[model samples]
Target chain A: MDVRSRNHVTVTGRVGGPVVMLAHGFGCDQNMWRLVVPALERDFTVVLFDHVGSGNSELSAWSPERYSSMDGYAEDVLELCRELALGPVTFVGHSVSAMMGVLAAAREPEAFAGLVLLAPSACFIDDPDTGYRGGFSAADIDELLESLDANYLGWSGAMAPVIMGNPERPELGEELTNSFCRTDPGIARVFARVTFLSDNRRDLSQVRVPTLVAQCSSDAIAPPEVGEFIHAQIPGSRLTTLNATGHCPQLAAPEETAAAIAAFARAAG
Target chain B: MTCGTGGEEGGRERDNGSGPGEEEALFSALLEDSTEDLYEHAPCGFLSTLLDGRIAKANATLLDWLGYRRSDLVGRRHFSDLLTVGGRLYYETHFGPLLRMQGEVSGVALELKAADGSRLPVMVTSKVKTGIDGQPLLIRTTVFEARDRRAYETELLRARREADQERDRLKLLNATLQTTLLPPALANVPGLDVSAYYHIASADEVGGDFYDLFPLATGTWGLFLGDVCGKGATAAAVTSLARYTLRAAAVYDPDPAAVLANLNTVLNHEYNGDDPRFCTVVFGLLTPDADRGGFHIVLASGGHPPALMMRADGTADFLPTPGGQLIGVLPDAHIATATVHLAPGDTLLLYTDGLTEARTAAGGEDRYGDDALLAFIRDLAPSTASDTIGAVRVLLGTFGTGVDDDTAVLAVHVPRAGSEERH
Candidate 1:
């Protein structure tokens, strides 16, 4: 009970129907959901806040030992939900945040109504028998980690193109690249390692909430098979394939992507 | 207790009785002559600590490396105070347990903080020195310099990084060279479905795989996909020559079997010496037939895997082009030629053995075989060439980095009139 209770959170929606909370991926803040927030705010209450050590969030609240794992981020999501009095909320997440959402939802199923996962990759290394094709080889991941340690900006520049391979939606890649570059280099390195190396396929099975996995057709980072893997593992989860390519389908095909999410939420509700 | 009180009083009495205090004289001589020299010049650093890891005694050698006076370390700081953050964790996790279990432990490596907070790599040995009756006492610790070993490891890592860079540069160059060996774009043959995919096994080394569809004499089209035997610049050289020679030869002959024959003859004449170049090629020629609205295709094989024929009615089987010898091996190679009629909606898939020969798993000998490919083709028999190719692309992506060699697939389908436009 001695834990800090003075923590504050902001919630906003004009034409509220239900609540949808979003958590951003590694090296990014809550501002990543800006493009999709406008569309969601039209129909639902949207709750947005940065995790500690990121964006508008208080940096003084960050403790390296506490924030060492995604559990800290999960606690932030749960705390934000509790503070906002948001019950049975739809949680939208990207990359590592998607797994964090899964862990959070698994921990408290009554708090989370559903999950919207975009470019969710459990593990980046390839496992032959399981037919999971997360693009990088073991040595490739090692080189990636080493480069992250040596020069974070250089690593982001190299990774951005690979993650966003779609030539048509160049802006999506630009946004991702910018978001990655904006992160503090030291924190970015640790966050990147945690994101890429984290194995969350096991956590998928524990998610009892209704889940929507909107996957890009030609994403080099999270291929369709990865989405299929998530769909197969998570019970009662629906998989919707997007014609868009690259990791961030929201930036590429926001209208169609948003429509799918809305439909899923409506159906679940 | 007996030695401390009784010996001290007896030593005083003996000093009074003896002429020059013999035992005390010898003890003083050893301390003055040998102890300081031993402490200063010993191979390892000698230090004592309190129960709280505080330094009590430290040798001059350890103090010199740390840029500290002996008085600075002893009685002032704990042993953990000297360690870096990582070293402190190691001390808590591994060092403390082993020291507690055994009376002594040795060869524990750690980074010790110097006087200016700079790091000094060291190997520490510690022992629990006890009283004569095994009662608890102070801890004794020894540390050795790890400067040379740390330097060697750093250099080795640097060298490894350089080697990796060299390999990556070579891979980029090989990718560029491989691009040149194949046509920039295969000439779009009208009324025929065309889709080709190339899978490179290792980017660091170039594999010889060349495929092209070129127009020949008499309104015919000749296409071939071949793999040269070896790798690197040598294989790349042969690949370039073979690709150009096949195109050039097809322009002269226009017959699929004869085009391959001429290519074989040219390769035999050019690279038929010691350390000669050899490759397996499957050549196909498409020509309009008067009897049927479809095209008559003659496929000549030179020691290549059979081309799969996925029919319009959803049945799939391999084209019979057997008994072909590997090109460039002999002066007169036996070429196997088979003629097939490509009606509307029929597709022909030509590929290298790399598709079938890829290992499915680590420590697994199960190659993704001909039967699996047949089933895969069977699933897509009634599809357009482009859809077939797109599906195959997805399948290849699924194979991921497991396909340890290059794979090239060139498919030509005589599509239904409207179907060709969509494809």
Candidate 2:
């Protein structure tokens, strides 16, 4: 199997530079890193890819047995890294992908130089017994699933709007609107369950490499304490809060996000 | 009141300098009321929110529909507050990011939570209202009620699930029906080795291939393998009739040629119509040769592929049963017979054309033909009947999806004095 075609892997940035691979979370594809890729291109060899069954990745490759849990996604990440063969790369994972990176690095620590986890939560559902708050209730996650059903027919209509008048990059408007975050609903359901319900808190201590836990200052999804919790769990990990709002710091504050990734890759390499 | 009438008659028509008639005066009053009335009583609800999603204004229609007062919503509620918990998460993760990037979004369906805790299904369209400096200021949203549309979608989803269930049930039914057309197990013929295998090409559609082995009257056995024309329900019906008729006919006559002739007569009479069904079959009658220490077998064919023999001396060839006509194709179909002595360490195999016609990886144009099967068995000569059947099964597996039709094979071998037990 051609792993590149299966995952829709794309490689860009300075050739022969230290590798930095970016993995998108749920809902969106590789385009989630469009804002951050430019700043990192000067210093690192960047890699971007969509998870299977999302964006332009091969839908036929996705099976419920393999992708129902976190292991399936983590396997794809390791396979992608193996396929690239760009020795000892730094992985920059966002949202749910942070957990995937954790799983991948834990399984094969030698494959990675360092890890940058952005706006991540090890588990999304709150556990009352342990007093660990993962930001959402189990019932709240179900509601989110219901919301996905509501938009089943409305997805195309939502994508139909023309993205006009973004002053930063007018030429990119055509490509941006249709391609961003358009996921197959069936795959999206499995991914949503995997992203929100999976508990990777126990997997954190297994990391044997340098790790950076980057948090957004005002993210509704992963609050500041979640970042602190992750940092405390990992051995000798550093936590830094970005001056950005929302769950997506890469898009909200790209320059700062990219700079953090580049600085880490250089120092870790 | 003819308001367009001649000049001085305007007073009776109640025309003034400002207006022509009472209807015109009423229209003028309505025109003056429209500005505020249009905003408050529009068919769809409207809301204007700050860039941060705080509601700056809520139309009276929106407030009334949601069972909320103007003071209760405006300046206090965010646009997401009107949504259900699920809708709010969806709005934040997908809809909010889209609206922020796209500048405008439309026809997004979401369920709103009313003050009374009931659900209100709605479709919303929102556009960013940018200031003159080209920075986003606030959002202008229009909400359309979609109660009927949601009900319709729910019904559609339910219907799709039923169809999927029905399809799965049909496949299970097909498989059960297929098993009934063949013998549960081959009858154990003492002092002789017998083996059979049937490969079903599809689970959904029942294939038209069958084989059976059973005991006849006294110290004799009957066996046959055949392929009925076409596939699915109609072909399956024909296969069931052919298998039962061959068994009953063999019990009556025990002669290989006579048994097949009886089957042809039964089928030709039963299906004489335009959609007449037919099959190619090979039937065999085996009797133990007391002195020669092997069985004497007579094989008959009805437009079927000839049987093959793998000999004790490491050689293989097909037994020619020429001039046989397809059963049920004519009033009097000719049955051709070939006699062979099943010597020790010699195996005779009967099969349908599905075996030879199987496509091979050599390309679409190539088939694993009669010559290839002859050569393959020649390589495995001096083999037992059970071993030959096992080898054929492995060969068929190599074809994978190339074998589109069902295949049936039955092999009979006479073991040498000290040969290994039949597999």
lDDT of 1 at B382: 79
Q: How does each model score on lDDT?
A: 0.73, 0.86
A28 Cα displacement, candidate 2 (Å) = 3.1
Docking class of 2: acceptable
- Residue B5 in model 1: shift from native, Å? 34
Q: On residues A1-269, what C-alpha lDDT tens digit does candidate 2 reach at each position?
A: 79999999999999999999999877777877887899888888999998998878888999999999999999999999899999998999998999899999999999999999999999988889998998889898898887787777667656665546655765566566556545778778888898889999999999988999999877778878899999999998999999876677786677899888888999997
In the order shown, the candidates' Cα RMSDs to the true structure are 19.9, 6.9
Model 1 docking category: incorrect
Error of 1 at A62 (Å): 22
The best candidate by TM-score is 2
Clash statistics: count for each candidate: 0, 0
Predicted complex 1: DockQ: 0.02
Give the true-contact fraction for every prediction, in order.
Answer: 0.00, 0.53
The collision pairs in model 1 are none
